[model samples]
Target: MTTDSGTRTPIRWGVLATGRIAESFASDLALVDGNELAAVGSRSPEAARTFAERFGGSRAHGSYEELAADPDVDVIYVATPHSRHLEDVMMCFEAGKAVLCEKALTMNLADAEKLVAEARSRGLFFAEAMWMRANPNIRRIAELSADGTLGTIGQVRAQLGFVGPAATARLWDPMLGASGLLDVGIYPLTFAHLILGEPVSITAGGTLSDQGIDVNGGATMTYASGAVASIAWTQVAHSDNRASVAGDVGLIEVPARFHHPTMFTHWHDDQLDTISEPVTGRGYAHEIEEVAACLRAGKTESALLPLDDTVAIMGQIETILDQLGVAAR
Candidate 1:
């Protein structure tokens, strides 16, 4: 972000996949001022070229490795599936590239830890792409909760669900590390974590598919502060995607699709206040901006989306799946 002549330099970004998430991130990347989608990479050459053409990338690589190795790309966004995150991100690190990888960090907690260790050992910039944490509204909620504005938080409730296509391999396939919990549940879980740290105990139950992936599930966690969190996620039906945090003095509610909320309401002292935060395109831009800021500051990790919390959440996901009897692959 510094300049010899006093003009800010754009951070050049490379996207490592051509999936829907990649396109969304690219769209938001364009919305930011000092960032550009410099390159795109996909296993299929045509896919890479087509994505670059649509997203305004100047270069397209036929493989993820090639993209990681591209000298012009300052940071690479690993947008591959959850199962491929560890491998893909490690490749980028080996190529001496900073990385912002899509969430679920990896298939399990161990792999997530491996990534953290590798990134730390190499002193490279790395972070999980948990866009929700970077949302202005979500960050505001966390601030209120942390600063005692919510007043002795005692409970948090959240749920996310949709009747997704049963035939969609990404939703039903175990090989792809697909599950309602990993795909959507992590949001509610993380919301709770941001308010109440790690839980002392977690009790969970849910339905599992014939393919051994979770179709629907919920958990109730008890924190050391005596706060309790209840969270649920499902791909089996359309459930209210809302979230609420309750404390002794007040309550805050995030409307449907809380993960990318633009506004939320708080109630206390017989007063209801609505707060609105301007979200950059689709809300992915905040995380992108966070990554760029971290790189410019020479920080290896994002404070908003820390690697330790990511690993802990992955552990929570693994424990929840085990309780649901989803039989890990």
Candidate 2:
């Protein structure tokens, strides 16, 4: 077991993409005390150089291999599209470097399992950057639910959706592994998983594009405890993005973006109560700190976003896709 050391030594990071998500992660890492943006790699040297200059990092390389081979980098952040996560993370793993991969861990369950197995076999840190799982608000929800504040948790309903224009955009692009389900559905699925655990029975239906990705979908999950959750996600319509948990005695409703909600409401037998909290920096810093903490302690995975849970969530997504007749290639 790895223990937290009082002496804080910065964990050097090698950024593996120059996309918006990568930039967001870099900005968030700046707010963490014990993380260093050691290097950056991009398909284009000019892009990598420009990103490095803007982010205040010295080593910018043109190829992923160069960045992965850098001995000074303690970990690599795989910020590429969902389809590339397997290749990017596997490269880093083969190079003997730890990885902090972006969410939707891979295109599918098989690749995700391979990455997890490799990390476990090598005793290196690996985590899906499901930042919401590390948020204070979500943590509080978990604590309250576990403590029985919701009273036997009978049902959960969550939706995350946004309107997108066409197949040209990343959200609609099949080559990029972009779709409503994988891009935004993970939020609701993860939220349900947090409160209800893995579902015993999963049923889903959706509309898929000619390109073969889910454009809009809804999943119904029934847990062994008789708790049921309904989750919906879409790129063609805008949704409330709210989540609710109803129990025998009371209910709780989370505000928009429930996964990273700004406030939540609790109703116990007609008395209504609302709890609000502020979060720091785009809210990605918390997960960055978590990865750093886990890596520094020599841990192979995060307690908040365990590998098994990630795999299970991906499997659920796979089932949903199977039911929808959409393949995530």
TM-score of 1: 0.98
- lDDT by residue for model 2 (1-329), tens: 22386566688899999999999989988988878899999999999999999997779999999999998898999989988899889899999998989888988888888889999999888999999998888888777777887789999999999888664467877888887888999999999999999999999998988888898999999999999999999988889999998888878889887878767888987799987766668888889888877886778888987999999999998888889988645
Q: Residue 275 CA error for candidate 1 (Å)?
A: 0.6
TM-score of each: 0.98, 0.95
lDDT value for model 1: 0.93
Per-residue lDDT for 125-202 in model 1, tens only?
Answer: 999899999999999999988898889999999999999986777888888889899898999999998889899999
Flag regions of model 2 displaced more than 4 Å: 1-7
Q: In model 2, what is the error at residue 97, expressed in angstroms? A: 1.0
**Clashes found in each candidate (C-alpha, N, C closer than 3 A):** 0, 0
In candidate 1, which residue pairs clash? none
